[model samples]
Every structure is written in C-alpha cells, then in structure tokens.
Target: MTTTELINQIRKKKSFLCIGLDVDLNKIPQHLLKEEDPIFAFNKAIIDATHHLCVAYKPNTAFYEAYGLKGWKALEKTIKYLNEKYPEIFTIADAKRGDIGNTSTMYAQAFFEDLAFDSVTVAPYMGKDSVEPFLAFKNKHTILLALTSNAGAFDFQTKTVEGKELYKQVLDTSKTWENAENLMYVVGATKAEYLAEIRNIIPDSFLLVPGVGAQGGNLQDVCKYGMSENVGLLINSSRGIIYASSGEDFAAAAASKAEALQKEMAVELG
Candidate 1:
C-alpha cells in the first residue's frame, strides 16, 4: 500500500495498530494442534476476530520457517487469506531478511512477487546494496531496522560513530538510496524518547514500531513523539493480543485485547 493509502486507513479505522501473528504451536490452544495446519488455523481465527479492530497484520517469518515446508505452506495460506479477504488491510512480512545482492533479490521476489506482502522488515547492517534490491519492487516497502526493542540494541545501535548514534547514521544514509520513498523503518517503542530526534531526520517516513503492549512501552508516549501528520506509526502487539488466551475462546480474547489497543489509538489519532 502507498503511504497515502495507509494514512487513509488509519483515519478510517481510527487506528494505527498492527497485530503481529508470531504464532507458535506450543502457545496456541492445544485443540488446534490436531488441525491439519495448526499455524494457519490459529492465524485465521486471530485475523477473523481482530481484523476490524486493527489496520495491519504482521506475520513474523521465522515462526513459519522453523516448521519447515509445512509451516511455509501454512504461512502462504494465511497471507493469501488476508489478501483475498481483506485487501485493504496492510500486510507485513516480519522476515528481517538481508543478504548479498543476488540472494537479496531472490528473497525480495519471494516475499514481494510470489507471496505479495505489502512490506518486509529488512536488516540494514549489510548496507545499501543488500537492501536496495528489495526497494526495487514497486509499491512494496522495505522496513529497515533502525533502533530495535531488544536489550542487545544498546550494544550497537546507540553506540556513537563520529559523535552520531549508529542508528541515526542508518536513517540518514538510507534516504540517499534509489526508491527510498518505499522505505519505512523499524523503530522500537521502548526507545520512545529518541523518536523526536528520529523524526527530525525523516519527518514523513512511516515507522513500524514493536515493543508496545507486553513490552511495557507506553502507547501515548510513542504517539506523542513518534506520530507524524499522517499518523505515521504501525504499533505492533504480538504476544499480548494473540496469546491473550490458551483456550477455545482464544480468538475472542485476542479480539478484546486488540480492541483495547485500537480504542486507545483512536484517541491518539484524534
């Protein structure tokens, strides 16, 4: 989806919430394990329950990858269901993929061409050549990792190089690449204080922020500093919403959690 389309969805739904489908067989309702494709079954229920409450859905690729070919097929089915049923809803492949130029091109084709995700999370440590191939795809977004939510982020992201924080340099350098207009960023909500500074560097770029909800990152604080005029935020909540229950009513429970976040997001957008 284009930036304008995304912003419009935020306005229409009064939400910037992106529900993360980080599904694990061990965490889902035990009954689902009997299904032919437990992962897709769980995802379908979650999507059905919460689709109206949020503007986006992100399925982290690793979850499916760990399960091998069967898992990949489940993910494919889940994504296809979302696209066909709710085409307006933004979809992200939280793949965090980055590699050499040729391999990155294949990865880009896999997600953007074959699977048809609206965006994919990419690691930028390999520099412009590795990420630019993903950017080459029309209308598809490359969400480059900037400041992450993990504790390990402090070990490098915040480290100064020539007196500028490393993440700031990433933000600055990424803008210089071709098709940079298709770029969004992964900025952790836990680092909310740095958002104002990050905004100054790229005032209009959208940020796909995780680390809210279960991560204890305050929603209001993220919106206060991270929000742009277009409501440039896709705040993600994975475990807190999707795993709200381990019972047969799991989908309904997930809906309730997503609804709570969406309600708060509506107020923030206003």
Candidate 2:
C-alpha cells in the first residue's frame, strides 16, 4: 500500500496498530494441534477476530521457516487469505532479509512478487546495494533495521563512528539511494527517546515500531516522540495480544486486547 493509503486507514480505523502474527505452535491453544495446519488455523482466528481493530498484520518469517515446507505453505495460505479477504489491510513480511545484490533481488521478488507482501523488513548491514534492490519495487516498502529492541543492538547500532551513531548513518545514507522514498525504518519502541532525533532525519517516512507490550516498550513514550502529523507509527504487539489466552476463547481474548490498544490509539490520534 502507498503511504497515503496507510495514513487513510489509520484515520478511518482510529488506529495504526500492526498485529504481529508470530505464531509458535507450542504457544497456541493445544486443541489446534489436531488441525491439519495448526499455524494457519491460529492465524486465521486471530486475523478474523482482530482485523477491524488494526490496520496492519505482520507475520514474522522465522516462525514458519522453522516448521519447513508445511510451515511455509501455512504462511502462504495466511497471506492469500489476507489478500483476498482484507486487501485494504497492509501486510508485512517481517523477514529481515539482506544479502548480495543478486540474491537480494531474488529475495525481493519472493516477498514482493511471489507472496505479494506490501512491505518487508530488511537488514542494512550489507550497505545500500544489498537494500536498494528491495526498494526498487513501486509502492512496496523496504523497512530498514535501525535501532532495534534487542539487547544486542547496543553492540553496533548505538556505537558511534566518526562521532555519529551507526543507525543515524544508516538512515542518512539510505536516503541517497535510488527509489529511496519507499523506504521506512524499524525503530524499536524501547528506544523511544531517539524517535525525535530520527524524525528530524526523515520527517515523513513511516516507522514500523515493535517492542511494545510483551517487550515492555512504553506506548505513551513512543507516541510522544514518534507520531507525526499523519500518525507515522505502526506500533506492534505480538505475544501480548495473540497469546492473551491458551484456551478455546483465544480469538475473542485477542480481540479484547487489540480493542484496548485501538481505543488508546484513537485518543492519541485525537
């Protein structure tokens, strides 16, 4: 989806929430284990329950990859379901892919062309060449990793090179590449204080921020510094919402959690 379309959805729904469909078989309701595709079954229920409460849904690729071909088929079905049923809702392949230029192009085609995700998370450690390939697609977004929520982010992202943090440099350098306007950055909500500074670098670019809820990133702090005139934030809450229950009523419980966040977001947008 285009940036304007995304912003419109936020306005219409009174939310910019991105529900992370990080489905782990071990964590889902035990009854689903009997289903032919437990992963997709769980995802369908969650999506059906919370679709109206959020504008985006991100399925982290790792969860499906770990399960091999069957897992991949489940993911494919999940994306197809979203595309056919709720085409207006933005879909993100949280695949965090980056490689050599040629490989990166194939990766781009896999997610953008084959799977038809609206966006994909990409790691920037390989420089502009590795990432620009993903940015080449029209209307499809390449969400570059900036300051992440993990403890290991301090190892390089926060480290200063020539007196500037590495992530700031990534943001600055990425804008110089071709078709860079389609780029967004992943700024973890755990580092909410840096949002103001990050905004100064790319004032209008959307941010796919995770690390809220189960990760303990404060939603209020994230909005205080990250929100722009267009509500340029996609705050993600995975475990907190999807795993709200381990019983048969899990989907309803997930809806309740999503509603709570959407209600707060409505007030924040107001």
Cα lDDT computed for each candidate against the true fold: 0.95, 0.95
* Per-residue alpha-carbon lDDT of candidate 1 for residues 153-172, written as tens digits (9 for 90 to 100): 99999999787999999999
Assess the local accuracy of residue 256 in candidate 1 as a C-alpha lDDT between 0 and 100: 94
lDDT for 222 (candidate 1) = 98
User: In model 2, what are the clashing residue pairs, if there are any?
Assistant: none
lDDT of 2 by residue, 13-113 (tens): 99999999999999999999999999999999999999999999999999999999999999999999999999999999999999999999999999999
Give me candidate 1's TM-score against the actual structure. 0.99
**What lDDT score goes with residue 238 in model 1?**
99
Residue 178 of candidate 1: its Cα lDDT? Answer: 94
The parts of candidate 1 lying over 4 Å away from their true place are none
